[model samples]
Target: MNESIKTPSVTDEASTPQMKTKCEHHAECMKVIQAILDDQATEAEKDHFRENIDKCIPCIESYNLEKCIKTSLADKIAKKPCPKNILNTIISKINS
Candidate 1:
């Protein structure tokens, strides 16, 4: 079996073509990203993002940042149960 993969040295990386730092469609990408994350994206939108994400680093980073924020909020926020007294009062008022 093959062992560990070899990472390029700093010098080797420096000599290669620079990775793209900007994406022209970043704004549009963000909108599509929101739709996708919110489960509102059409199948075509999902396919488009999947096709472009590998080449567009800016969009990829934005997607990751948005995902992290959503995940953190979901995991950290506490859910509290309503007090029984309040629940009883609301039910009594509705019945009357």
Candidate 2:
């Protein structure tokens, strides 16, 4: 037996009701979100994101959730140090 998974096309994904209701600027919003996460967004992109967040409830909620998750993860990592022994072991394994 053979099985395959089906992936939705960009057009199909963009046409969903949820996507439509979320924001007409969905593509731009996503680009801004990704750029912000990657720390590569320009001032214009940041401004665009800020503007959309004010006008789009869904965009604001999504942005807030992502920002919360990212901040939580960074805070947790910053507070936790890897043990020296574990770090050395991993380094040695990689060197081998």
Candidate 3:
């Protein structure tokens, strides 16, 4: 069987994602990015973010930065015994 490989046309907008020239919703996108990075965003929100992230430079940068920071902190945290007073309070609350 013979087949022809189709090349994407330069003028095809669907083939190429238009890079955002200006980050107009930078502030709102940052909040969404933070929620996404922190595992707090809903699936719909995440889907929206995934769809648009590559098109927005600022949001992608924020997502990378926040992810890096969270990973670093998780690595650096040294687990220790909980404070006696706080532990007691938590236990009491749980028992109540």
TM-score of each prediction: 0.63, 0.54, 0.67
In model 3, the clashing pairs are none
Every candidate's lDDT: 0.88, 0.78, 0.83
Cα lDDT tens digits for candidate 3, 1-96:
446876667778577877875788888778888888778998888888988888987777778888899899999999799999999999999999
In candidate 1 the C-alpha lDDT for residue 93 amounts to: 100
Q: Rank by lDDT, descending?
A: 1, 3, 2
- Among these predictions, the greatest TM-score belongs to 3
lDDT of 2 by residue, 1-96 (tens): 335866789998777634224587777787788789879999999987766666677777777887888888888875668899999999999999
Local accuracy of candidate 1 as per-residue lDDT tens digits, 1-96: 556877799998878866457988888999999998888999999999998887778988999999999889989999899999999999999999
Point out where model 1 deviates above 4 Å: 1-19, 81-96
Which pairs of residues clash in candidate 1, taking residues 3 or more apart in a chain or in different chains?
A: none
**RMSD, each candidate, Å?**
7.0, 15.0, 6.5
Model 3 scores worst on lDDT over the 10 consecutive residues at 1-10
The list of candidate 3 runs beyond 4 A from truth reads: 1-14, 85-96
Candidate 2 runs further than 4 Å off: 1-21, 37-40, 71-78
